[model samples]
Structure formats: structure tokens, C-alpha cells
Target chain A: MGLDPVKEEQNAALHKMRKRVIESIGRNMDLYGISLSTGHLYGLLFFADKPMTLDEMGSEMKMSKTSMSTGVRTLLDLKMVNKVWEKGSRKDLYEVEYDWYQTFTDFFDIKWRKSVEANILVLRKSMDEIDKIANEYAEDPEMTDMLQKDKAKLRDAYAYYEWLDRLIDTFENGDIYKLVPKEPPAKE
Target chain B: MGLDPVKEEQNAALHKMRKRVIESIGRNMDLYGISLSTGHLYGLLFFADKPMTLDEMGSEMKMSKTSMSTGVRTLLDLKMVNKVWEKGSRKDLYEVEYDWYQTFTDFFDIKWRKSVEANILVLRKSMDEIDKIANEYAEDPEMTDMLQKDKAKLRDAYAYYEWLDRLIDTFENGDIYKLVPKEPPAKE
Candidate 1:
């Protein structure tokens, strides 16, 4: 079911090359404000093999001892990562959340909530502006007609956002899995 | 034909609401590292009705004249957005990237290229460590035997990344459209 000895050596080289690329994804996360550190990043990188120690990650990344400790803590809190307690080690170790599509919900929930809040602030202000225009144009015959149209339009839009905010709130409340269609469910 | 008055009012409200949301999105582009400006965003927003001046957006968002001048220039350079000079007047009017999905390739191209290069560096180093483990164990007959088996399984995975990277590249390059189903082309 596998390759011969000579073929196996070539396969090993390719596999190493693959892991290296996956680890490089670590660098991208940092640039993107993804909040992952080189240690936590590589700690998860080695998850494919076995767990690694705080001291081991420091040497590989050439980071200070204090930085590694804090960095690993940050990863655990975001739940973008996790701690793996090996059977034999007294020290703590970190790893990435392996199911990427699943783990991303934890991350997206934070971002989408912020955007929704910001948009709500914006919509509320627009509603007030429309009301102001309606008040100012109440007696101007032609402008009253135009202002009425704008006010009515703005009110409807506000209602939609009101509904959307409720839907997203439902998403944040731990039952998002029931709502969102999972990507590529189990294959036969 | 459209809906009844109550229904029509609802549709117009949704339209207005979307406009406000889009306007907020345009203003918040900077937070996401997107290049559009408030003037350009509002210019595009109001253009469906008529070309609006920087003054219109400044009045809406209560921004200074200087800010509008600067924001408009940045949007023009991105090419998905641009300015139109009105006859007999020097007012700068902006328009949206109506075919934005297509233009996203150009936008993402700029963002991804800069970011991907940085991420690859991190991944490469993480990968180098895995290689070290392979080389060290290569000398011991039993370790070599185990690595040979381990490496084969991982190489299959690495090939996947190479395939993914290449697949996305092809998807961006246009040939993918030939095989991919598309919505009916819209009339000009």
C-alpha cells in the first residue's frame, strides 16, 4: 500500500517541504493582524508530529523566553489555538485549532459583531438626519414632498438593519452552527 | 411591474438602507486597509441619482474640505473608482465599481501579493525545522525507517497546498471561467 525504500526517501522530502509551507502560513497571519506568534504558530505547526515545548519554540523563532510565554497565552484565549498537555511534560504547550473552517467562526464572530455595531451607529445617525430634513421642509410645498419620500425610504432601511442585528445576535449566542450551512459536510 | 404602495415603500426603504450601509462601508474602508475615501464613497453613493460634489459628503459626515480633497485622489488611483468632470463646473464626482466582483481580483491581488510574500517567509522557517528533524534521524536505521513512513503521509498533504495555491492562481487568471458555471451575462 506504500512506496519502496528509494521512493520513500523522495516522499519524505516532499512531506517536509509541505510542512514548511504550512508553517510559513504563520508569517501571513502576523502580517494580517491575525494575532498569532511565531512560537504559537510553529507550536501548532509541529502538531502534525508531536507537541513542542516553550524552550523549543524560543530557539526555533529566536524569541525571548518572556515573549513566548505571553504569546502562547494570547493564542489560548482567542480559541484560535489550544493547549496540549502531553502525558509526560510538566510545562505547558500550545497548538492551533486544527479544524480551520470550524475555528474561523470564533474569529469571524468577533469581526462581524464589531462591523454590525459600527453600521448600527451609522444607520441611527442617518435616521436622525432624515428626521431633521423632514422637520426643516415641513412647510415648503415641493421640498415637503421630496423630504417625505426620503424619510419613508430611510425608515424602511432602518427596520432591515434592526432585523439583521437580531439575526447576527442569534449567531453570536453559541447556536451559530444551527444557522450557518457547514462547508463540505462528511463525504461518503 | 413593481409592488403595491406599501410593498413599494418597503423596497425603497430597503434600497435606502443598503445605500447607508454601503456608505458606512465606504467610510470604514480605511479600517480594513481598503483605499476608498469618504468623498469618493459618497460621490459613488449619490451618483445613481446625480453627480454629487465633495461638499455634499462633507455636509453629511461633517468632515472638512481638506479631507474630501485627499480622499478623492486615492479612490481614483485604484481604478475601480474614478472621477467625472462636469461641463462648465470643476466639481469632482465619483462612481462605484459596479462590476465590483471582477474588480475584486485587482483589489485582492494588491492585498494578497504584499501579504502572501511575508507569510511565506514565516512558513519556510517553520518548515526548515521539520527538515532538521528528518536529517538528524536519517542516520539512525530505525529512525530512518520510521521517517520514511512518516514522510510519505505528509508529502501527500503538501501536494494539496501546491494544488490549492495553483488552483486559486488559475481561478484568478480567467481560464477557470470556462469550466465554472456562470450566471447569464447581463445586458449592457
Candidate 2:
């Protein structure tokens, strides 16, 4: 079919709109520990009409195919994108996760959960060591007092991390949505 | 008073414990867009007995005074630390905010709220532009449909941001603490 003027103009408008939002997304992605360019790449895929190949993405993004591959790999690892098998296509195809709420959950669930769990592990190990030292130094009143104070502080910190662990659980288990509903209330 | 042997040993143990936790905090600092060293700086202050001067922090961290100053500035900007005046002391002193929950709220309130507000602004501007274009092309039924679809998508994205704005308010106003209590429950 011949190119229609109105259709062409409409396409341009849509592209511009998506580009504006994508740039904003790119700029703010550092909060999520993602690079600006990677954010742009994800935004491109998000607005793509269909799953994109690395070659297609590279050309559109004006990035090297190697870079595109790396970015896509990061997105895939974060569950921000999915790899799909396209019938009759030899190359890998990738698509963005459309649900922003799910994207938020996945990103936090992975990143925060890992950090929280690692810190908790360290806290427990440190507390255990403190307990051993406290027992060994019980005969010395000054040493016992110091150990007790430090142990109490560690216990307080541990409580905070425990609460954080539970907070991460809310995200992972979808309980956070109950408190902060995924859907925004209807606009006034 | 002279340092007794038992007291010295206890101090060593406490120092080691703090160091371990500090190192872990440093490793995880990237999640908050902070340098590992800055995280270490914050941890040092967190475990400190009193507000420290830049020189003292530099010596303890084995960092240049310049680097310590920069790190302290960043921590200050994040509200992770505070500058305090000490009577009869000429040097500036800084201390870490002790409440981890408040630190969490402040860090996220500043970071995520700025991001959410910025994204919402762009979404609004883009939607307005779409509306202008749709009105300009009112005669074209196809263009109107295209604009409407794009506008809807932007609206959906805006809703998410709006929800995020409210979520940030929870952090700011401490409503999130109600959902995820700052203190962990009493242990059995």
C-alpha cells in the first residue's frame, strides 16, 4: 500500500511522544542502578511494536551490536525483558516487560533482597562471634560491659535488617500491592 | 585513665565487628548511588562514639582529607549524616544519623521522589503535546485514533507515577512504617 500522509504524521507524533518519555526514563534509571544508555535501550524495546533482534536494536539505538547484546543481557537478567523464540527466526528476540509495577517489584526483589540477605548473614556471623568473645571474657567486668554494649547495638541493627527482610518479602510476595495498590486511583 | 589489657582487647573485638559490618555496607553502597568509600565513611561515623572532624575521619579511613570531605558532603546531602557544633571546638564535626529507618526514608524520599516527580512532569508535558497535535489534526480520524492510543499509554504511565508519588509521601510521612514497622517484632 502507498504511504498515507495522515498515517505518516501520526506515526511521527507517536514516535516523538515515546521518545520524550524514554529520555525521562533513561535519565532517572540511575536510581535503579542502570546506566542511561541501557535505560534507553530498554525504553526502545518497551515502545517497540514487536520483539527486537540485537541487530535491529543496535541500529535503532545507534549502538554497537555487542553493546546491545550486553544491555539486553542485563535487562534479561533483571527480568525487565524476556527472550522469546520467534518461529522461523534464527536470531534471538527480546521484548520488554510491559507491566511497570511488576518491573518495580522484580528489580527491587532481586537487588534489595540480595543486599538484605547478605547484610543479614554478616550480622548473624558478627553476632555469633560477639557471643563467643563475650562468654570468653565474662570474668573481666570491663570486657564484659564493652561486649554487652556492642552486642546490644548489633542486636538493634539486626532488628532493623529483620524488618527490611520482611519488607522485601512484601515486594517478592506481592503483599506490598495491598498497601500501595498497583493501579493508581481514577484521576479526579 | 590508663587502658587496661581487658579493656583493650574488648575494644579490639568491637572494632573488628564494626569493620566487618562497615565493609559490607561499603559493598552495598552502589545500590544507593554512593561510592563504597562513602558508605564506609558513613559506617565509620555510624559506629563512632562522637562526631568526628575531617582529619580524624581521614586518619581512621586512611583516606585523604579531601576525599573524606567530599564523602562527608555527599552523606550530608543525602541526610545520612549531620554537621554539629561542639562547644570550644573550632573544627567542623559530622555524625551519622543513627536511625536506620529514618535514613532509609530520607534516602529514598530524596532520590525516588525527585525521580518520580520528574517523570510525571515529562509525562504531563508529552501528553499535552499529544493533545495539541490531535486537535491540530482533528479532521484526520486515523491521526486522532493514534493520538488517543498514545495518550492512553501516557496516562497509564502517569497513573503509576502518581501512585509512586503517594508512596513517596508514605515514606516522608512515616506511613510506610505502619505497614513495615521500623522495629522488628519481639523475638520468641
True-contact fraction per candidate equals 0.16, 0.74
Worst ten-residue run, lDDT, model 2 chain A? A1-10
Interface RMSD of structure candidate 2 (Å): 2.8
Whose DockQ is greatest here? 2
TM-score of structure candidate 1: 0.50
Q: State which docking tier applies to candidate 1.
A: incorrect
Task: Estimate, for each residue in B17-103, the C-alpha lDDT of model 1 and write its tens digit.
Answer: 546656676664543444455533543453233455678656644678677666655555555565777888777776545443344
**Per-model C-alpha RMSD:** 10.7, 3.5
Docking class of 2: medium
lDDT of candidate 2? 0.82
Model 1 regions lying over 4 Å from their true place: A1-24, A30-32, A35-48, A86-90, A121-125, A140-188, B1-31, B35-93, B96-188
What is the Å distance of residue B146 in model 1 from its true position?
Answer: 7.6
Q: How big is the positional error of residue A166 in model 2, measured in Å on the Cα after superposition?
A: 1.2
i-RMS of candidate 1:
10.7
